[model samples]
Target: MNPWVRLMSKNVANICIMLILPLVFIIIWFYLAKSIDNTVILPSPAMVLQLLSHPSENLISMGSLTNNIFISLLRVLAGYILAVMLAIPLGILMGYYAKIFQLFNTFVGLFRPIPPLAWVPLVLAWFGISSFATLTGVERGILFIYLNNIKLSMVFIIFIGAFYPVLTSAIYGVKNVKKTLIDSARVLGASESDIFFKILIPAAKPSIVNGMRIGLGVAWMCLVSAEMLPGSLSGIGYLITHAYTIARTDVVIAGMISIGVVGALMDTLFRIFEEKKFKWQRLIR
Candidate 1:
């Protein structure tokens, strides 16, 4: 088979796995739900959907369930975006500078291990019961994650979840170029900028795209943890908590389903972006 045809076949296989596996799991879940004879504990998918569709004061009002979902999403995006923005530059600096890296290593390690919940009280006191406060608390934790990720971005984390693995890969791709190539460029009297942009960045294209996909995955994965702020109504996490308080199993399950869907959507979007942005990067090998 042609290499391109083989690559396309592999892509199709991967997509099929992602789609079919989940549906099979859901079927098993529904079967188990019926077999257990416990409506309260494991509500079937249909039950959760019923709850989602039924009108309730908490779910139906304009300031309804969707409001919470949107609010939580906004918080996650804001916090994640801010953390990533700050992480990338600082990461690049640390990657390039020994003095700067050493100066902040201790501080990052000091509180990096602290749990997100641990900071809730302090963040609440400082920022109060607002979106800012909740997200700020989440921000602190993610900042630490990003900081650590950035510190390693140039090393290996960039390959996994650093700010943008693909970008980092692209950066290193050029740096790893044969010395002869660079020397030849210098012999040609090309400027430093010319050698860098013309050679280095283009070489790192695949790695750079990989980094973005990884970063986006991390951000989406952390969405729930980031939303666990102290205060206010709304969000999948908050919805789960609020529903649990009233012993509303249906509402809680509905929230879980919503969260799952949202998480899947995020991953789906990342995949789509990668496909569009780096279609050629996909390799059968």
Candidate 2:
């Protein structure tokens, strides 16, 4: 067989396998919806699909599904970025230095077990409803509205959710780098900065990226719970909550599906990056 044809056939088989579960899931959902005959309890797949098909259309006066999802994305990114910026550096330092690790490991371990939502009461007490808009002193206009949508309490929750995974991964990656490699670099007259930047980081890039991918997923999950808290007016979580209150199961399902789709897309991008950039890491395993 020709190479191109073989590749095309392989791709088709992969796509078919990927879709099998979802098709079966939809069929089962349709059956259940028909049997129960209760839209509130379990909506038909068609109803949810119809809502998803028109994502731009406003639902239950909580904004369009797309708009709500976008808002949630923004909130996730705000917290997730902060986590990466702080976690990566601290993790690298801790992993590289025994004293630094000892100094912070106990403190980190104390907080690691606490769920992000568990901090809601404390975060609310500290930040209250104050948001980016409050910190920036933007009282009016479009900028203020967007900034105001990002509550500090919500971001803190997201950061907490994303931080530990990233920090752990970075530490593990750096610590696990071959001791011989460090000794070799030292023998080669490499400076401390060169060993860190050129040797340690380059070798640990795969693990760091993997951690970031996981952190992003966790951050996205945290968005729904955060948005359900006080002061949240819009976002997929809020949309789902509002829909549930009014007995609009279809809209709630649509919001959930949107979150799944967005999370999957983001995960796919990370997978692609990992495959392309760290192919050697995969081969070694």
Q: Which stretches of candidate 2 lie over 4 Å from their true place?
A: none
> How do the predictions measure up, each by TM-score?
0.65, 0.98
RMSD of each: 8.7, 0.9
The candidate that achieves the highest TM-score relative to the unseen native structure: 2
Error of 2 at 177 (Å): 0.5
Q: How far in Å is the alpha carbon of 198 misplaced in model 2?
A: 0.9
User: Ten residues in a row with the worst lDDT in model 1?
Assistant: 150-159
Task: Give the distance in Å from residue 91's predicted Cα in candidate 2 to where it truly belongs.
Answer: 0.1
Model 1 C-alpha lDDT per residue in residues 1-285, reported as the tens digit of each score: 999999999999999987997799889988999998676677787877776785354652224567566665665555446545655555444533468767865765565455444545555565453433333344456453333222111112111233333334433444455678768989999998887668545545555555555666565555454445443344566667766776667777787777777777887787787678767656623
Per-candidate local distance difference test: 0.57, 0.94
